[model samples]
Target: MKRKKWMSTLLLVLGFVLYFSVNEPESAYAMHIMEGFLPMGWAIFWWVAFIPFFVLGLRALRKITKETPELKIMLGLAGAFTFVLSALKIPSVTGSSSHPTGTGLGAVMFGPLPMSVLGSIVLLFQAVLLAHGGLTTLGANAFSMALAGPVVGYYVYRWMMNASGKQKLAIFTAAALADLSTYVVTSLQLALAFPAEQGGIAASFLKFGGIFAITQIPLAISEGLLTVLIWNWLQSYSTNELALLQRQMKGVKES
Candidate 1:
């Protein structure tokens, strides 16, 4: 990126956002399902489903710490990024708003398993301190935004990197697509729990997905750009540290 290219990208994303916001009626702020909005069974199910990922992330974190204690600060900063970015809700054309997950950067940098723990903590803090999401729906939210998004994002980035050897392109694609993936999983969760009377699960999923895409797609594009900018800055200033992380990742892969 050149400055002109960057401006063009920003303008395009802004156009999408403005088009949706102007076209659709103002809606409720939404990212994770509102606190305690899901049925008890659904909530419990998501919690159970998320437990394995959470535990695996803890194990991964422990391993990383034992190997590279210097990375702890980086991990903390990544978690903070996720928390802060996700807290900013973009109103959508649908009745609910959406926001960026900010998990893709962590997934690309530290790997997805570690991000599961990082993302879970961010989500937890948001629910408890900010009242953005609910305790009861934590599991569902964690499953969708934390585990699912990061897993897909990590693989997507890796795949793109391997194929193109273009870090910026890979980062943008991973971040944007991962954000979309989170909402897709979220729509599925909502559909499964509350199927529409006419079209059932499929119909309900489309309804939810269409609604969230209004805000989410543009937010995803914006997040992708932001991630690239931040990563480029870090790469320029922290070349040695970034190399160390890359070496650690290589070591993990070899093992």
Candidate 2:
């Protein structure tokens, strides 16, 4: 089973590289929806929408820190991991760039709300320091990549963990789908903002989704594989930390 999984992962990587080589765009925008890309109303709307999640995430993070200080390093590492992964952009045919969210593992480990905080921080850093994302679109970008992705990814991880019994498979699927979900949500946001003249929002969604999927699908798969590898490495080197995380997850599930 492990061999098969590795082989499949190799194939996926090869396919991603092949596709990237063949269809690499001449110029493309960086990831996270860019800055000032959305209208004032839409921007404010997303900011308002994200505020509740951000507050909840902040509370959850504080609780975690107060309750289990030992896990702080692990959580910091997870946040850094997400920041690095998201900062690396792959240009898409849609004239924009997409990248891995790195939210699935964090969501599954620390719960979705905490991941929301971590993801928001990453987005903020990218917007301000790297200039990858934008100040205006921070809310929209955070809503899609941080809140939506983690929520979906956490639930998917729960479902897969319950159904599969294969931890690797569950982790990979959850992480991959989480990454894809961000793009899906972004597509919807863009579609709603700039509906197609002929077919409206639905058509525009399809158009944006189709364009993003070309690069995003491969990125999702790669992130999934990377997540599994990271998990394996943690299991080997940080067994105690992993156990503590599992206990936290169990506590969350029970409560």
Candidate 3:
């Protein structure tokens, strides 16, 4: 894309993200586990689990910045889209709430490693500034939303693309599943932390998962549609960027 066009696209993406970032949140409650919500042991466990991925992601991110300097515009769009969509939290039937993962597009374009870094940055900012998630629970939140969702999205898109050779179908399915997967992991996290007296972790998982399903299923579908729309928009206006992504994608999964 031309400099003027890419700049315009960035402005629009940034504008949408900024509007929501500045908007007052509806609930003090939010999508991810809240501040000090997890036990210290679980918190530390999750933080430890998340660190390796973030470190690898940093390496992946550095490689991208150094090697494909031109694709930074698309990178910005991906980060902005994740921020804007994920920021829209809906209070769910559970004690907390749910929202779109918003990592699918980034995963599709730049792979999961890049999104691990981008998505964590999104979580970090939201935790500190928006009070949506928290510093203590950031690891749990990032693991579910950033790592799990994008890992699913990246592989699903690749599998779907190979099996069906239908870009839109692949994008929709991957994006929708990515959103749902985040809630699945979150439910598991919550379940492990607070097991039910009657049936233990299994029952608690069912309870949390069931409650999240009520709201999250529809949210995932809506996010899929929105992702497809944005994908189409990029296809139309960001051909150069897409071309760069195609080149990058070929090597993204290689060891």
Query: lDDT per prediction?
Result: 0.84, 0.84, 0.86
Give the distance in Å from residue 169's predicted Cα in candidate 1 to where it truly belongs: 0.5
User: What is the per-residue lDDT of model 1 for residues 114-163, given as tens digits with 9 covering 90 to 100?
Assistant: 99999989998888887777999999999999999998898999899889
For lDDT, the strongest prediction is 3
Give me the overall lDDT of model 2.
Answer: 0.84
What does candidate 3's lDDT look like per residue over 1-255, in tens digits?
566666765666565445444442466477689899899999999999999999999998889889999898888999998997888776666656677778999998888888988999999999888887899999999999999999999899999998989999899999999999998999899999999999999999998899779878987887787787788779878789898889888876565
Model 3 stretches with alpha carbons more than 4 Å out: 1-25, 93-96
Question: Native-vs-model 3 lDDT?
Answer: 0.86
TM-score, predicted candidate 2 vs. hidden true structure: 0.89
- TM-scores for all candidates: the values are 0.88, 0.89, 0.89
Q: What is the Å distance of residue 118 in model 3 from its true position?
A: 0.7
Better by lDDT, candidate 3 or 1:
3
